[model samples]
Target chain A: MKARVTVTLKNGVLDPQGKAIEGSLGSLGFEGVEGIRQGKVFDLELADRSEAQAKADIEAMCEQLLANTVIENYSIELL
Target chain B: MKARVTVTLKNGVLDPQGKAIEGSLGSLGFEGVEGIRQGKVFDLELADRSEAQAKADIEAMCEQLLANTVIENYSIELL
Candidate 1:
């Protein structure tokens, strides 16, 4: 099974990286961009496993290493 | 309008960050992890615009700022 994990900053967290990108876009003359938030994506190739098992494992991974949890949120998708 | 841009490293490009993540997972006792690749996601809010226009603008942003087109691929989703 293949899995994806998307990690995003929690609401109200300061995002300097996103701000930088927004500034750069504005400088480059790409107008109409009101706001931007940046996040992380992890694409995984896992050994063949049951869907349930894969999800469970990925959840654990997110909880343990993939996300800070205190300031970040993560979503998992299985394919 | 809202848009999402996902930028991923092109195939055959080395990802030291992903390698480090894989090593960390193994050390943390996450088994069945065959491989890992890391990418980026940008969540963008745009001034009200047609879908086609939003996509076009975002594509230009990607080509010029969001992505290093020589070694990365980007996809845009409008919401």
Candidate 2:
């Protein structure tokens, strides 16, 4: 099985890296770019686990390692 | 308008960060995880630009800033 997890900063959280990228975009002539927020994606290959078990495992993965729950939210898709 | 850009290590590209994460996952009792790859997502808000223009601008953004074309591939979606 394969799974994809997306971890994103919660709304209203400050993202300095995204801000820096936005600033660079403006300097590079990308006008009208008001803001940018950055996130992470993790693609994984797992053994033949059931979808339900995979979801539970991935949720635990996110809470334990993939995401900082203090500032980020995560969602997962199993394939 | 809003846009999302995803940058990922190209196939065959060595991803030390991902390997380290996978190692950590095993140590944390995530069994049967064979491999993992990590990517980045950038969400942006733009002024009233046409979707075509936004796409072009974001392509430039990825080429110049968001991705290292030497080892990464990026895709952008406008919303």
Candidate 3:
């Protein structure tokens, strides 16, 4: 089975990288880019498991290391 | 309006960060994590525009800056 974890900054958190990218985009002449926030994506290949089991495991993973819960939020998708 | 851009490495490309993350997960006692690949996500706030316009603009952004099409694939979502 395949799983994906998306980790993103919580609302109001400062994102310097996102700012940098936004600036770069503006300088590169890509207009209409009002604001940008950057995040991380983890694509995982897990041993075949039930959706419930996979989601449970991934949630644990996110709590342990995949995401900084204090500043970031994560969502899991199973495929 | 809002938009999202997801950039992921092409298959067969070496991803050291993903490898390190996978190793870390193993060391942390998270089992059944077969393979892990890391990618980037960009969330954007665009001036109110039609979905077609937003998608067209973002596609250009990806082509010129957001993604290295040679080794990465990008998908855009409008919200």
TM-scores of the candidates in the order shown: 0.98, 0.95, 0.96
Return the top candidate by TM-score.
1
- Encode model 2's per-residue lDDT on B1-79: one tens digit a residue: 8888889999999999999999999999999998999999998898987778878888988888899999999988887
Question: Which candidate achieves the best DockQ against the true structure?
Answer: 1
- Superposed model 3: Cα runs more than 4 Å off: none
DockQ of 2: 0.87
The candidate, 1 or 2, that scores higher on lDDT is 1
For candidate 1, the chain B TM-score comes to: 0.98
Candidate 2 regions with alpha-carbon error over 4 angstroms: none
DockQ of each: 0.94, 0.87, 0.88
True contacts kept of 1: 0.94
Q: What level of docking quality does candidate 3 show? A: high
Clashes of each: 0, 0, 0
Which structure is stronger by lDDT: 2 or 3?
Answer: 3
In model 2, the Cα lDDT at residue B42 comes to 91
i-RMS, each model, one decimal: 0.5, 0.9, 0.8
lDDT, candidate 1, A1-79, per-residue tens: 7888999999999999999999999999888888999999999999998999999999999999999999999999997
Candidate 3: RMSD over Cα atoms?
A: 0.9
